[model samples]
Target chain A: MTDPTALSCPAPAAETERVLLGHGSGGRLMAELLRDVIATELGTDPIAEDAAVVDTGTAEVVTSTDSFVVTPRFFPGGDIGSLAVHGTINDLAMRGARPVALTLAYIVEEGLPLDELRAITASAARAAATAGVPIVTGDTKVVQRGAADGVYVTTTGIGVRHPDATPSAAHGRPGDLVLLSGPIALHGTAILSARESLGFESEIASDSRPLHALVAAMLDAGGPDVHTLRDPTRGGLASALNELAETSSIGVDITEDAVPVPPLAAAACELLGLDPLHVANEGCLVAFVAPTAAEAVLHAMHTRPEGAGARVIGSLTDEHPGRVHMRTMLGGVRVVDMLVGEQLPRIC
Target chain B: MTDPTALSCPAPAAETERVLLGHGSGGRLMAELLRDVIATELGTDPIAEDAAVVDTGTAEVVTSTDSFVVTPRFFPGGDIGSLAVHGTINDLAMRGARPVALTLAYIVEEGLPLDELRAITASAARAAATAGVPIVTGDTKVVQRGAADGVYVTTTGIGVRHPDATPSAAHGRPGDLVLLSGPIALHGTAILSARESLGFESEIASDSRPLHALVAAMLDAGGPDVHTLRDPTRGGLASALNELAETSSIGVDITEDAVPVPPLAAAACELLGLDPLHVANEGCLVAFVAPTAAEAVLHAMHTRPEGAGARVIGSLTDEHPGRVHMRTMLGGVRVVDMLVGEQLPRIC
Candidate 1:
């Protein structure tokens, strides 16, 4: 566990006199802000997990909340409305929860096209229906024209925990196998294309979709062997790995060649001078499972459309605990660090 | 019940081509948008209550979500952070729920002062602690400098419903007595004063508070006789009464002289050409109870500091169903309609 004292101590006054975009970038700065500011104020050590599991007397329930402020409301594959629902659902899935209901709160700017709002609502409703989750309640607030962007959606999801599931980032142990479900970086690149209006020859669409069913499949197959589950979102794969390492106090060794990055997304990243490993993926997830059940879990994941491209990319190690290392395609080793600054703000 | 066919029909092309601030004003336009646009797409009747109750197998739970976009982050009595917590908690309380946990999601603008964020977080933490509700999960997102205001906080609260409570707006019956928990319009006036920097002879502080304790007391005293409970927020007393009337298909007759309104708030509303009944109140609530239990509920409410100014303001009737009427101080009755447009935007 991270030292409680270290987590509570305030960051240097000079380092964070004001909040930069990086503080919300799901990177090192965001981690620091959450640990030193939010956690300190709450007088608790930061859980640093995607969702919090609470025991509701009769059952263990998981709940998660996320606010979506993506630049262009409509991206290549999904809009902010669907993204909001997918994001929160994904968080609950990461905790091995079967989502039951969701609540949406919208902060809309004055004078937004009613047609646009209607389209977004219809899209959100469809997404919820497709996921078998209902938007049970919602609230809407409007600010002055210039006080806000077109709209911001925040979604909170409630789900029932899988009966046999007990996944946590802190459960990863030495010899655990690390798996990546599908490709990475699609979401970030797609949003950038839409925001910049840069049409590429091969369109990169966001992989934004609900993953509760995929998670349920994995749990049904691997059970308690699945040590940890995480959606590589805002901070992408590198951040997810680093977080897992830090939380479990274990080291992760992975091969760059084994990580999956779609050709178009890789090309887009290269052209934009970005790193694929550090870019966000809305529809993909990473799982740390017991080596004994690694093959079974991978097989189960392969049977699902969302995880058809699942592969074993890494393994937990005793060496260099609390850090992540990646082997280059050339057989050279390099440290995979949490993103240092804002690479792309509002990408998720 | 409203006509399902009418709700499903899209608004005439000429009537609403875009979303106006009034659509989020918690008034007639906002109700129309929710019923005609949002609810229609979801394939469910609009639930005009503060929170939605869901059965969790072993226990019934109530959940609510609210987005706080108050202009001045810091107002007379409280800041946006505390307001966010109190607002969601009050919503749960209105459903007769004992708040268990909360999830907070913050959308912040780039370059906001970190000091401000920390202060707000600390305030929110204190408020949650005071209410005995833990903020179990949270997420933060950041937009570019000009893309958003300083910050908007969305809070989702989860609570276990009281065993004997079955409060709902549709539960109001004819002959039920209306009660005001406290003064009206203090929150609106205080926010306006802070936003416009208008100095009043005497400071008018927002009545921003969590009301779960008072609500519990009322439930304890009135039990099933307490037909409904609502916090007079954005659209204030008039809007709350109108919604109850419509939901129950009953008439509400109130007396302007009997409703509690702080003298300072009344003066501020008069100076600003605003109706006290139409302005918001963050800490107050309106309750409809059986005539037999009215005195007991009011007495129990008066014992609590939050409801010290409680008063019997009106009664429900069969005449003029789905409408509200107010007997003026001059002994003349007049119709009280929901506000037609935004009275004060972003006042929490």
Candidate 2:
């Protein structure tokens, strides 16, 4: 296991002084901040999972939180409101939990159009209704015009753990196979195109959909053999896989041809000189399944709309434990490392 | 019952166009935003309770969320960190829940000092530890320097419901007695003084504390007799009483002299031309208890440090349903109304 204290020691003097955008990029810097500062001070053990499971003496409850500050607030497939709901729901799903309730908190800037706020609220409500989870309570705070962006949404989700499932990033075994639920980088590409007006907007739409149903299907088929489940969100597929490998103390091997990427998003990534593997995704999830249930899990995933793009991208290995190696399409081996700094900020 | 849709009516054109600081002042505007917009769109019934109870088949879980963006980051009694933790915990406690876990999320401005963030994190950790609740998971997102203040902490707390307690503002009856947990307005006074450099720094400290223990004692003593429990945070005692009166369709009658306000905070409010009853408070709570159980609840409250100033401040009456009135020391009665607009912004 990585020592949480070690992440603090090597932080450069400059990096340790002022907060950087990279510190919230869901990359190495973000990880360092979480472990060295947040975890150490909060006195909680670091776990490589999207949500924490609390045994409430009766039933285990899963909880997670995320803040959405996506610039522009509105995007192609979904707005910040919908994104906020889906993001927290997906986090609970990543832990094999059935989301039960969500709480919405808004940090709205003064002078933000009330009509716009209404629209966002409606969209969030619709999203929650569609997911069948109720937004049970909410809080709103407005700051001075410049004190905050238009609106930043923070969503906290509560879910009940599935009795038959127990999934964790640290549960990955050496022989476990890695699976991708859907095409990668669509959300990242969409946000970048919209923000920079890169003209790829019409072609790429964010895959910002809820993945709890997809997770439920996979859990039904794989049960405890699902080993590990994670939504490749802010740090994307590369970081998700790296986190699992590090937590499980196993190496990962993937084939470049096997990792699914939408053609339009791929072209956009290539044109922008961005790595598709390093881009963020809102809907897709990465799973490590035991060899015995891999095929069944893949078949089950294919039956769900969100997981139609499911495929076995790689397998956990005993070699190079704690690292990921990719077999390039051109027959060359390369180490795939976690992102070091900001790439697609606020994509989710 | 207040018709939720009526709040959306007669909203002046200018008011409907953009959000004002009043919409977040925890007053009438904030109430309208919640009932007319958030609740209506989300298709949920509004309840005058700090937290929502979610039934998970086997257990009832209470959930609440709050965002703290108090300016200056640090204040006399506590910093934003402890406030974040205490605020959410008190929300759950007000709903008669025993906190189990909390999720902390931060939207930090890019240029904030890391040292400041560290201090805040440590303070939050200490606060959570003191409350005996673990901050199980967290998320951090950094926005551009202009996108946010130094840092905003959003805390979501999850707690198990107390079996014998079922408190709600709507449960108040005409015969119920209103109780004050402690001295009020210190938080609002402290924030205002610190923000304006009003030189009352040493004398006034924000009563930013966790009140779950005090709540537990009250619950143990009064159980089902505690009709309503609300933290007089934003909009202070006046707003809290007004909300309870409206929710219960009853009238609240208070004696001005009986309301507990710290001497220094009261003086500060007088000097600033702010009403102590309208100022915010952090640690204190307003409870509506059955008349027969009022003395027992107050005695139990006084047993806890946080509730040392517990006393009867008022009682519910049928004479002026949906209104609050205070009998002045000079033998004059005046109607007290909920705050209309922002008195103090970003106090919590």
Candidate 3:
């Protein structure tokens, strides 16, 4: 027989077996461990199952998956469970697919209380219902104490994309009109101020939202005139816009005054030595429209409560391809760069 | 303007911010972060045309997504990148979908060497090509140096599901023959032996594979007789069987003699105090077939290279719903339990 050491599981208290950054590496190591131990043992699929089953339809279906690893597990307006469903659905909606079914995969730490899990699950179900999506499948697994945080949920969603929809970074072209679905920075600021370090509170709360309805409306009003659609997520507006600029090999021009920045977000950015344009925003979208159709697109976005705050924030440019130059309040220009670092890591 | 304290990003470099178990909790805290930050900011709906354009689909497609968080990033048979793609494609095929497009989301640490990132990406691309899956959309961001491992990849895949085929856990029924597509435990044993503390030398390599072809064969052969299908992932065969038993609410009686075991896997398991039954198998599958169609199913599986080691490992029983029993080589009965803790982390 092999030495007992060779057969042992990592002890929760053992410093050597402690969690490392490599645990998150999307490498063979993570795959093997998850498959052989956690997933198989948990009675779930070891290989990821993002889009498993979908009904064929006239509206082409699009599916998206997201894993939430935000700290605290609770915040101002929403929690992880709700976020899991909404985030994935929004990903599909961006492709102009009406959100449909969802699968929730939860990795819960052993010591997590039943109440919390139940609450999260309940919230997830509720969120799905609220967004007109169904949580058709789910899985739960327990990690050894200290092996993980309370719980981590990976949500996979399937939706139907509109036939005329052509949404991707590469589709951006010079002279496209850039529009905002709503105000920026509320979500990031609310969560930040909630932190103990700041111990500050305001009317501000996360601007979490579901975008399927909003997307449906925009697509309906704009038809094929919409050149691109994206929800500014991790790296926020700057990072997301920068990616599009580079992909389409076009420059973008945005006016600081034109972009909607709620006062709360503005106040928070001033103190943090950060740029509001660079800060993160949820419940907001950046759309590139045919310059001629910009007015119609703006009108369509305003049709929804979530998009009421929407406005024309910028436009694509032929000069300075692959650059994003923001117009300051003083009418001067400043370049927007991808977040020097994620606006907040582990935020999602 | 807010004070500097209020301006600071919620996730500071404080030791507490490094990582807390609460971060994984699927509660309100986690949700708001994802909704407001990750999903809201970077993942804007690309269909809006102002942000970016993402393809919905033209052909039937299969898509899957998973995050890698295994403790070790390297194993004997593979590393994280290769495993990421294989695990992904395998999932797509399990749904009988032919994989085509993939989206890679990467979270990198600030201080990671450029070479490591390049290497992992290359490996991922190679694996995708090998499986005939191309990664057309990707997103990358860097976290603080210590916030994450060198990198973590979350791959979302899209493929076309097999026509006229239905595969779901709910499909399993009573009195069905069970077929294991390949020899098991190569993945588990390889990872176990590769542990730093339990160092042992064995030719054991992870059984990671893309099982689309294998899936196709069994479906074609079984025709209408195939009742259910599943890929034993994370916890190994025992966990998978246990989960299926619970889901199907049926008893599973397997003959140790009928289950194919590679000599190396068996020897390694014995030496390491691990049960080969609880080990993970990637390039493997467990199919349930009606008694009348069992022969055709077996014949179809063995015809394929991936199924050469296929065997009739067991059958479902109507009695003792939601339980599993094993007939040992000595004609003894034993219960197989889901894995309690990780046997080896990241054995995908």
Residue-level lDDT of model 3, residues B118-217, one tens digit each, is 5666677677777766655444444444445555666666666556666655567888988888888787777767764354444667777778778778
lDDT tens string, model 3, A230-327? 88866578877887887688999999888878786787777766666666566788888888878887898888999998888888988999889998
lDDT of 1 by residue, A203-296 (tens): 8899999989999999999999998998877667887787778778999999999998889889888888888887888899999999999999
* TM (chain A), candidate 2: 0.83
lDDT of 2 by residue, B42-122 (tens): 234432221122333335677788888887789999999999999999988888888888878888776565556667877
TM-score of model number 2: 0.84
What is the RMSD, in Å, between candidate 2 and the native fold over all Cα?
17.7
Model 2 C-alpha lDDT per residue in residues A1-348, reported as the tens digit of each score: 998897776755542242333333222343454455334432344322211223333456788888898876888888999999999999888888888888788887876765566678778878988998877776667687788877899999988766788788778898999999888989889989889888998878889999899989999998999988888776668877876787788999999999888888998899888888888889899999999999999999999999988999999989999899999999999998765555655665
Candidate 2, superposed: residue stretches over 4 Å from native: A1-58, B1-58
Q: Clashing residue pairs in candidate 2, if any?
A: none
Error of 1 at B227 (Å): 0.6
Q: Summing lDDT over every window of 10 consecutive residues in candidate 2 chain A, give the lowest-scoring window.
A: A46-55
Model 2, position B5: C-alpha lDDT score: 89
Error of 1 at B46 (Å): 38
